[model samples]
Target: MEEHCLFYLAALAIFILMLVMTFFISSLLQTPPRRHKTASLPLPPGLQPLSVLGTFFALFRRSEFDVEPLLRRLHSRHGPVVSFRLLSFPRPPIFVSDRVLAHRALVGRGATFADRPSAIDPGLIISSNRHNVTGAPYGPVWRALRRNLATKVLHPSQLRVYSPARRQVLDVLLKDLETKSSGGAAAVVVMESFRFAVFSLLAFMCFGERLDDEKIRRIASLQRELLSNFVSFSVFAVYPKITKLLFRSRWKKLLDFRSKQEETYVPLIDARRNLLLRRQRSEDGFVYSYVDSLVDLEIPEDGGRKLKDGEIVSLCSEFLSAGTDTTATALQWIMANLVKRPDIQTKLYEEIERVVEKDAVVREEDLQWMPYLKAVVLEGLRRHPPGHFVLPHTVTEEVEFEGYRIPKGAVVTFSVAEIGWDGAVWTEPMEFRPERFLEGGEGEGVDITGVQEIRMMPFGVGRRICPAMGLALLHLEYFVANLVKEFEWMPAADGEEIDLTEKVEFTVVMKTPLKARIVPRKRT
Candidate 1:
């Protein structure tokens, strides 16, 4: 009886200790008490101060598509620069709409704002611990990856080498469109075809092999699934530990998606590796691919360790994804505009006829001679920039910009849509007029790169400007010229108009996908 009493007392003591520990941990996990705003440097006006719970609910109330419009309204009301914080997000991103100030933040003092946000999000789950270039921390590793991408994948010379591959993909795309749009008058959705074409092109460049239509379609489907989930809040992004402990279902779904990605990507990576081995052994002339270049690349930061298979897979995924979605979405938007404005389409077609040979494929080299084509693409990018906000940038050190003090560790993103359509920069910015880029026009001699000054930055500017800008332009220009050259794009039957309403997923795309009645244009 005495021993039993002692055992009960020890058990009770242990239970009480565990309860205290649990309470302490819960308090720590809950949002910390809000920090008072700096007295000297006030954040730009937006979002009234609210408690953590209040802020989370209020901030997330707007859908992702609505977020940009809301910001634009705020910018008009509260000057060009605006800052807001959410209880859930540790650092609030300051949205900059003023062109000169944006240039200063992104280019003039770029290194200060060069780092990507250190967010624990689902989007980064497959980034090979941020080994790939896009999300890698600004350092030696990033430099090495960027250098490799610039030299091996995105260089002008490398693009020249890939011209044949581009032509082949374009041919495949044309054939697919012809078959799909064969039904008379009734329009078919072309977004899927565009996506397949673009994804296949990037996939070929990455893996160094052409896949069958079915296989390519399968890969595209899997990638879309992954990308959709990537942007959504998931276990990996928020409450990482709790997700594992209690949200097993969400955790399992992520794992399954990742597994599918691996299954699709790993084999392609292996095949590419084998191709490299064969090329090394044989005396045959070899063309280098993105994977081939990555295989040869040695990371100085990792003690000259060559990238592993998983890392290769990650890089290839980024390559496939970045190239596919953005270009495809842009293609749809540009084509939608063409369908909506037949006059513009007619002018574009007339220019193509003047420039190119009858019934011939559009080549990358020919793009230089065609300024109107360039302007049309420029206008498409301007009116509907793929992303409303450039990826959020973290300030490495505290710096003042245009009399506003920016604190270190703050997230900053320039408003691509706002800046593109700034009335001060472009007259009638909302109107889609490619002629604006012609000589003596508002955008004439404008520099897309913010090097001289940022007039418009659809591809972003400065140290973090997209390395693939050149390749992307080539894709857009080449495909747009060809698709217009082949087909007379018209609006769908029975008063169905092109809906320009955008919905943000992996990229901002038309809320209602463009379905166009297309007929093969007669060539003389």
Candidate 2:
């Protein structure tokens, strides 16, 4: 009787798979009547043009979680811009690796390509039904959210108001590293320290107060849990009405995680609201926070109602995760590279020493006079962008791009790492050479925003570019400068060299977390 039940379950799964495959194939084979004459143009080239079955199987064979390798192969086979579809997907996702084409689509026709794809079940649930900035559609709500962050929180003047928080976090990081390093007698793994430090800083900025270590750790764990399982949760996004029943366990787990996240975050949101109502400031004075902005914001598109607790939680989650993971990942890669190449480290240290006083911490303003420091940060971003691909974008309407027709609602993405490594733009793009950005170098005067031409874009480009770009750059420059100034990073005492091999997590990070023997710099 048990064996019969097992067989029936297996059969049901197979039948469901076949049904999904058939539905996708029929959709691909069916041609809808054209609404415009431009619709006659050919679609971008794809990997398997022979049949829909071939394309489905080809995509199935590739790892669904890691699409970089598949995208590279597709681009090599079919020029820079290519499209691929998996079973049950509504549209063929187009990928562009060519810089010129990326510029044309993302910048030249910025507004047309500014919109994001429809949010899936997990994203919708976590983002409070697509109310947050990242998941919100490109329109009035998106504009309001993005503007609030840019003008109220992330603006330069606003960022400077948080200097005390930055210094406090820096001191905490230094103390933690000092304890772990044990006066240069011990080797330390720095990624955890990097992550916690950044998380603490962002938490302070989010909550308007410095949270206790336990609270910070709890928040960090919850955010990391979401990011670690984010890729696996994609399964629930497909055919959600059916997947919720088929994968009931996973669906339950996602719901439980969201519940825990809300439990952890809502209290802080309420505290901020209460503080605002009391109209009182702590002894340190009123420090504006991201949540404060969210709480006070009135969405004109949504009948001018203020954000609810759940929506605030979602935005705060985005703020903590985005700022923490990406910045920490970049920090690890930069420090690891410095460990591997001491010559470059020495050059950077000398530059820092020249600009900063002896025994003094590297300040945000000092970052400007140090050109070599800027080059090193730029090199780190180019050599190891935290994310290999930007968030997927969709076209607002059917449009002609690069002599091919992109239908309305088609999913579009760009190969960020590939564009930054384009050989035509940078000489020996694979090498970690900061001189490439120095005067008389090939990469000098290169714009990372992809405005004039996309030599490299670590934070993406165009109208929908990362609103936190300025703040992120400041964090990188400030932290990298101080870290190099604080210690001379060296390979671990075990005689093993620093491993730069990357592993993709929430962001692409060093496979082997950077283990370095850090000797405190003896400044005058």
Candidate 3:
């Protein structure tokens, strides 16, 4: 009787504890926004103070309202720069739409403004903050990874080396489009088709081997799944102590999704490790790809000198996420926009036709003489910058700005989309004008090489800018040149109106995928 009573008591105690934790989590996730800490004052005039719930609901509605349009409205109400909550974090990001502040945040400020904030919910964990190059804290590790990426994968010389794969992927894409067009499938969502093309190019670059079409598609799907979940509330939920206990199911899904992603990545990684053992380093020569470079990379970890398999997998996930979607989505948006405006499409088509003629293959080197080709891509990036905010930056040091004190670990972010479309910088901010980048305009002084004063940073900027930018552009230029040369893309049987509504999944993409009718322009 005594034992039974004690057991019941302990069980009841645990039940009460769990009940309290669940309630705590629910309330924590439901934290009021205005109660959150924000920089005092500097609140742009006439802006209503946003509560935690208001900020959450506002951004939560973006999938419906779209990021750009929603931000535009917010900018109007809050003026250029304003404070808003992200996820459920008490301290929301200060979205800087003011170009001056944006420039200062991205390029002007030193590491003080660029580092990841410790208080930001998901970012405190070493894994969320450190595992990969992009998430790596703004420090030595970031530099090492950036150096490796710049030298090995994104160097101009390295880009020159992969020209063959670019040509091959374009050829495969055109062949697939030709077959699809002939099959009377109405139209292929050439945007996704473009993604497949970019994927093939990047996968080959990353894995150093050709993946079968089905395998590539499977990988793309997994990547999209991983990306969709990455920056979501699940990660942030894990940070809040109360929600951490309550949202166990959602958190488990994030882990499961991550594990599922690893399911796709591990096989490729293992295969490459095996390839490294059997394959000879030939002088004639077997080109070392990104995976090969990573294989050779050695990073110090807890007294061991080599990167662990898990770390390598994580880094590869970052690589796949950064390189694939940015390139593929940019290509999709560009193609869709061009289809909408036939005049631009016609000029682009004529330019490619002028050079490539009947040959469906457009080489990377071939893009050199076509300034219009470069402009079209520039316009694409400018018009539809992939990420609206360049991954929330954190201040690592106490800094003073605009008569306000910014303490250490404040989450800072610049409105990347807003800056490019700012009326002060470019005329007709909303217009898709490739002409802005012609011979001696904004793009003339622009460095296609990346890593300079980022005029249009779809790839981001500073020490943490994407290492795959060069390869992404090569993929874009090579494939876009070929695809346009092959097909005069038009809207589906529905007519010229292509749905441009944006959806933020992996990257900002057409909510309705670009399904277009392809009238073959080049001789099959």
Candidate 4:
């Protein structure tokens, strides 16, 4: 009986495999239809002119982590726009790298191009299939969620109220740095410290309570576990029905991670809720927080339904994860650049010193006075954005740009790295020169948002632009200044140079974590 059962199970597995292969072959032989009434126009050039299945199989040979180099090569060989078809996908995703084309697609016709991919959005899973700002379809739900965050949590007034929390987190970061760099230790890994700093700050804003280091670190670890598993075009990129049936383990893993996250997040969220209720009864005021804002928001589209606890948890998790990793990764890259080039570091340090006393803490208000510091941050983001592409955008309707047709519900991504380093936009796209942003320089008055023209869109542009752009910029500026002011960052003393090579995780991070020597500044 056992032998018979084993034989039947093995045969069943073989049957499923054969069915999938047969479907793939049949799809490959069929010609795809154009979105418009016109005959099929030529797609932007890529590896080969294969049918959808062949293209997917060829692309599948490259792992999720390996897409960047492939994309770079394709953009080099092909023009600004490149297209690739996926298995069973309705349309091929078009990647745009040209500034003019990007501006045209992402900004000029923002509305038509603003919707997210309708099928199997990874964020929907991560967000518990609730109304998440990043992954929700462009509609009344997304608009309401985004507006709540924008007006209540990320507004200038709200950020101002959270300034004290930022300061407290900065103190935690400085102490950690001090402990690591003390006793003439070897170069310390900067990424870990950077992660702790940013995560701690976001946690405070999200929970409306200052968590101890241990609790915050636990949450950070779990969140990283979830994000590290989520690579672009991984299992979630496929059709949802097939993914659920065939890739059930992946879904299970995501749920397990979400479970672990809730274990850490639920208490905090409930505490905030109870506190808000208590305040309502006792008439006691409290500082604003992201969760507090979320709790109070009533969705008009959903018949004025308030957010559920699980939805709140998902939103808070997204807030913490999104804000922490990207900011931390950008901070690491910027600091690495400074360490790699001491001349730039000295110029920034001098500028910082000139603006404020040596012992003074760099305040948020003081950032504007330092042009070199601002230039350094901009240069870092330009050279190495946290992610090479923004979250994949979906077109709500058929659109035409520069003679190329974009079908409705197709995925579109813009290459941030390619555009930022385009020689046509910058004098030397590869060089790390902050002075380019000064008067009469090629990058003078450069707009990070490509509203006017997409010279370099690091944080993206148009209606779908990162809502936290202002806060992200402030975090980068504040931390970079303080770190530079606190220590004279130097390359590792053991003849090891700063490794600028990037490996994508949740963000484009240093392949070799940044470890650098630190000499405490006398003023610090």
Candidate 5:
């Protein structure tokens, strides 16, 4: 057994060595593109531009999953806009932390920086060759996908149609919490419940029907499996042809996961298709779903053909994923803060009481009148935006900004968390003060869309901003208001204080999942 173990270790070491050699050779063979003589702008300040090995070692020092600290350090040391190369990629990727530069790049020069970098194998395969909105290159296909979502589903009027679904999910969540809390006798770990509830809501929106607990749990489990192993799958993205062969088990796992996803989602897509077919005959009690939109969408860029089943599966997967983990993560952070700061919780509850009548559930219409609820939600997003960085964006053509020449096809990412926490823009940025967003506060009249200027963009900004931003805000406000109004959230009795320490997953979640004592609020 010892001999066999030694033999396997030797084989692994040899494989790694060969992989490094291959990278080195590729790096040497790739020639740098010549810049136009008229456009001799320097690249952003970064590590020694010519040192491929140094760049590799620098990236090696930081875990790919948690690069926030490394990026923070780089921004502090080299100023806001930093650039560095990775492996054999032709151009160095730029990381922008300054809000001003972010505005200029993402808003002012929006078109130039709207394109997405070419996807690696995992992204390409999972997105069905960039068929989904988030993964598609900035082109006709992206426009079509995004327009469908924004117009047919995410538009404010369309979102109002899902209020009943939201209320039903909220009831389930309250029941689950009430059961676990046991009249404040027990402390409940709420992240899983939050995640499951949000997934259930999104699943309903995606499939246009109420899924049973078993099916919702099954689908959520599959998605959680994918997210949990996402970083591990990155191994298959690098030098995929070789790594897929070398990491055979991981490759098989990726394929198996995709197969399972297709198996699960295709039936739902077909069901929606069948519903569409029947709608022509009897248009009775039909609610339009996200899948229905995808089923009917014809991409002008793709020869006007309707989306294939694989693409629909991918689109539905994107819809569930984009809405589920991020919103659930935000809910956990917001509720955790409420538990930690009873004063704020009390203030928010008072506002809810003033707006919502006793014995009546908080309604979507009631949310519009609750200013403090919006403030609390905004503060949660500002302090703990789900993603620390936006998805990497690429340049459509060479452009110059802030004296740096951004080459075409170069990857650029903005620091969403860092920008939100900018001390210059936010007062006592680290503290959770919802009052800042109230009237006569620093955050008053702040536009999250970044149209005028980017004070704090939790949902991002500019053309590529999250299309579902309105829906997400509505969910947050409605859920937070109802949760606070129904229960008094307090620190767990088990001596576990609310810990705000963060850990990176699919989103930045509480390092310690929130376990809070909940007492049902009395009504007069």
Candidate 6:
């Protein structure tokens, strides 16, 4: 799912050949580094290195498609802390999954570990660079960008102000569902529908302009096409140079796409800029959305010039992307689990019914009274994180953990999905038990912040956590509350079993589109 290998293997192979040539040309011209004293760490004697490269050969042996299994193998063999070399690139990065080590990498020794390595999406580097919060490395600039997002865009007040837009989109989604259900059986590719809903809401919220279904779908499709380019799980962000060679054709296409995407963004960016200029002059009562906030503020760090159009556009791109696919994919996964468990769905519906009378559509105003609805949503995030792996964090210095050495510049990643399913961490890890989130259960309203211990980091943790998380959760809660309250969902006629196989792109997605019958709730 991550690497749609069949679609672009030939192109990737050619790129690999090209990259191999490049590597040789560069290696021959550049002088090799002089040998140094063996870097040793205080470690338990039992641990032994299989080779000078530690885990390199085995990792290199596996193809790009083998990443997950490769990670699993290293985790199993090396016990959470593993080291390997990037064949094409010069970095000898390590991967860690131990909770403590991961926390150390992300938070405890934060600054030393914060800079995100540049990946192949030159668009990401050239367009976004450090100006955009999402791709910027950790420092004064990164903090400034993130601080801006928090204060100007992601603040609670901002979320509350945009509540109407979210609820309106949820309303639209429900109405669409009603139309679809009116037909005999709804072959709800809930994934696509969910993506559309999230993107539509994000596009509206970010730009303050509601796009039609076709327009929103085209943007969503382009985002998807771009996301599918690398396909190699987590490689694009961590070991992109090597991954770039593997996905060479895609790299070129991404280059072209970056230019086109920037072009497409120009009109929207200009419209928002013009509107903001007008709103600021008029003192409109309506508070600015993210794009508006971006346009109004000067990037103090960047020569005190007004934010560049390309930079502002990149910020908006992050708003659309971070807000859309991840949340929508999570919504689909939640629905899949909810659809599979009729009892859970019934309990959720009953709770909503008690909170808001039958024939009453669930509204944001009514959410505070419906605890079960909140629990169901949390359970969904824990059960099926859209991004199974959070974007990778590279280590800045050598560190020792659990009697093992984590050399400097290792690429560290946390398994958000694995944490949710760790039996030791979550009881009945595989079961779709929303009750786990109920008042007295093991997962009783656990703070989703992931600060203390990683109960679940579905939206990620520490500095690298998704900035749009609160908005995403709000979107999920409101949408799920309405959809479940309005319909008693059932499996399609062909079979009773609810298949939940994954077909990943940017986010892990359901392979078999969730097709089901939605009998309307009893009218008043």
TM-score, each model?
0.89, 0.94, 0.82, 0.90, 0.94, 0.84
Root-mean-square deviation of every model: 6.9, 2.7, 6.6, 3.6, 2.3, 5.3
In model 1, what lDDT does residue 148 have?
A: 96
lDDT per residue for candidate 2 within 261-380, as digits (tens), equals 999999888898999899775645789899999999988765788888888899999999989999999989999999988999999999998898987999988989999988998999
lDDT of 3 at 271: 77
lDDT of 2 at 107: 95
- Model 6 lDDT tens row, 436-498: 888789999587776776677787777777777877787788888888887778887656788
Candidate 4 C-alpha lDDT tens digits along 74-95:
8888877888755444567888
Please tell me which predicted candidate would have the highest TM-score against the true structure: 5
**CA lDDT of each prediction against the hidden true structure:** 0.80, 0.86, 0.69, 0.81, 0.85, 0.70
Candidate that scores best on lDDT = 2
Name the 10 consecutive residues with the lowest summed lDDT in model 5: 56-65
Q: Which of candidates 2 and 4 is the stronger one according to TM-score? A: 2
Which residue pairs clash in candidate 1? Answer: none
Please give the TM-score that candidate 3 achieves against the real structure: 0.82
Candidate 3 error regions (>4 Å): 1-74, 77-79, 85-92, 118-129, 183-185, 231-241, 277-279, 283-285, 300-304, 440-444, 447-455, 522-524
The sequence of per-residue lDDT tens digits that candidate 3 reaches over residues 121-232 is 4432314446677777776666666677789888998777777777777778778887887744567777667767777777877887778889988888877776665555
Error of 1 at 463 (Å): 0.4
In candidate 1, what are the lDDT values of residues 1-524, reduced to their tens digit? 99978975674455445545654677688885544344366556775545543443443343533567678688778888887765424456688988888898888888888998774745555777787888887878899999999998889987887777788888888888888887335688999899988988887788766778788888888888777765444434434664354445766777788788788888877776887777662444456789888888899764778998778877888888888889999989999999999999999888888888977877777789889999999999999988888888888866666656667788888888888988987999999999999998999988898899988998899898999998889899999999998889998786777889888887889999999888888756
> lDDT tens string, model 5, 282-343?
56546688998998899986468888899998898889888999999999999999988889
As for candidate 6, its clashing pairs are 2-231, 3-231, 94-410
| Model 6 root-mean-square deviation | 5.3
Q: For model 3, what is the C-alpha lDDT against the true structure?
A: 0.69
